[model samples]
Target: MKKSYRIKANKEFQHVFKHGKSFANRQLVLYYIKKPEQTHFRIGLSVGKKIGNAVTRNRIKRYLREAFHELEAGVEPGYDIVIIARQPTKRMNYHEMKKSLIHLLSKEKLLSKK
Candidate 1:
């Protein structure tokens, strides 16, 4: 995913968390806030230390970024989204993680009908 489509700043993540609505599945929690002026969606990801070691956490992040990239076309634009991986994700593969994320986004109507 491109840097422009990522939520990098701590302040940005805080804004999304504080103002956004949330949804979750067993493996992930999603927070989102709409920004109508934005041309595309932006994402932030969090994988807590309690979930795993550094390598495992990094792997989870990579899977999430790739999933978002692949789902970019169908996801609603003009929103800032934050995803927090849960303990169950530590044992998941990329496909499973993607599926879990899709479930959360779909619940909130963030993934556009395709």
Candidate 2:
């Protein structure tokens, strides 16, 4: 993911967790806060050890990045978005993960009407 699009700071992640609205499913939890002052988005992903080893966790992040890339056009901008992978997410394939991500984002009304 591009540096501009990824949310890399601890403080930013905390801000999202503290202030964002959340939505979840078996595979993922999404937290999002709208930042009207901004013109773009910052996204973060969390795939902890509870889900898997480093390799497994990295795989999840990779898949999520790709999924987000694919859906980026449809997503509304100006939000800080965080995606935390759940235990079940460790075993899912890219398509499943993509679907889960979209579902969660859709629930947040983050996906555009198109």
Candidate 3:
């Protein structure tokens, strides 16, 4: 994911958490708000230090990002999405992470029907 498309600032993250609607499942919490333009979706990832050390946190974030990228085509355009990692994510492998992410997005109605 590119920095320009990521929600990085504290203010942005707070805004999304405060204003955006949320959906969740066993592995993740997704907060989303519709944006004006229908060009592309902006994504933000949150993997806390509480999950583990820097290495583990980075690994989780990377797996999440890869999962998101694979599912990007299914996501609706003109939305800001924040994916917050949950404790269960630490125990999950990459394939499990991908499946959980896709399932959550489907439940949130963010994924397009194939």
Candidate 4:
């Protein structure tokens, strides 16, 4: 994903966590807040050390970023979305990870109808 499409600041992530609504599945947790002024969505990915070593954590982040990129056009614009990987994600492949993400986003109606 592009830098402009990511939430890199701790403050921004915290703001979304504190003020946003969230939804989750066994593999991933999602927190999101609407930012109507923006024209596109931004995302923050968090993979805890508890999940694995650097390589494992990085792989999870990569999968998430790709999943979000694929779902970009269908996601509701103007939202700050943060996804935290769960223990289950360490064993999941890209397609499984994407399925889990889609489940969470759709549960909260964050995916656009189109």
Candidate 5:
């Protein structure tokens, strides 16, 4: 995703965690807060240390980012979204991860309906 569309502040992520609504499947969690003043969505990815070492965590993050990038256009434009990878995420390939992401976001009603 573009840097402009990424949520970079730890404070923002924390706020989202505290105030945003969340939905999840077996592999991914979606947290979102409506930010009507903002013109576009901002996304954050969180893959924990327990998932693996640096390389594995980074790889998981990359897959999450790619899924978000593909889904961004179909998502509503005024929210702060955080995608958190669960433990099962370590075993998933890109397509599985993407499918899990879409499932989580669909529950949140962010993505356009199929």
Candidate 6:
């Protein structure tokens, strides 16, 4: 992920958690809030221990990050996005995960019309 697109600050995360609207599909939960900046969009991924071991958590995070990279070009500018992985993600392969992520983003109208 590029530095400009990364969600780096604690304040940003907290703002999203507190104010962003959320939607969930089978594999992931997405939270989004509009921000004033137009330069770039920021994204954060959360994978919890309740889902699995460290390996599984890391694997899920990696999958999510890759999926985000693929879809990043379609994302609208000036938003904060947070994706939280669910237990179902442990059983999903990369393609399935990617599809789910895209589906969720599309549902949220975050993805630009294509």
- Compare the candidates by TM-score and give the number of the best one: 1
Tell me the tens digit of each residue's lDDT in model 5 across 62-109: 888888778778888899999888899999999999888777777778
lDDT of each: 0.95, 0.90, 0.87, 0.93, 0.88, 0.89
Model 2: worst 10 consecutive residues (lDDT sum): 105-114
Give the candidates in order of lDDT, highest first: 1, 4, 2, 6, 5, 3
In the range 30-60, model 2's lDDT, one tens digit per residue, is 9999999978777899988888899999999
Residue by residue across 3-95, what tens digits does model 6's lDDT show?
777776878888998999999997899989998866678889888899999999999989988887888789888898999899899999999
Residue 91 in model 3: lDDT:
88
The reply for model 1, stretches above 4 Å from the true place, is none
Q: What RMSD, rounded to one decimal, does every model reach?
A: 0.6, 0.8, 1.2, 0.7, 1.1, 1.2
Ranking by TM-score: 1, 4, 2, 5, 3, 6
Could you tally the backbone clashes for each prediction? 0, 0, 0, 0, 0, 0
Runs of candidate 2 exceeding 4 Å displacement: none
| lDDT for residue 60 in candidate 5, whole number 0-100 | 95
After superposition, the stretches of candidate 6 with alpha carbons farther than 4 Å from their true spots are none
Report the candidate with higher TM-score, 5 versus 6. 5
Per-residue CA lDDT of model 1 for 1-114, tens digit only, reads 999999999999999999999988889999999999999999999999999999999999999999999999999999999999999999999999999988998989999999
lDDT of 3: 0.87
Candidate 4 Cα lDDT to native: 0.93
- Measured against the true structure, the TM-scores of the candidates, in listed sequence, are 0.98, 0.96, 0.93, 0.97, 0.94, 0.92
TM-score between model 5 and native: 0.94
Which is superior by lDDT, 2 or 6? 2
- Cα lDDT for residue 73, candidate 3: 80
Backbone clash tally for model 5?
Answer: 0
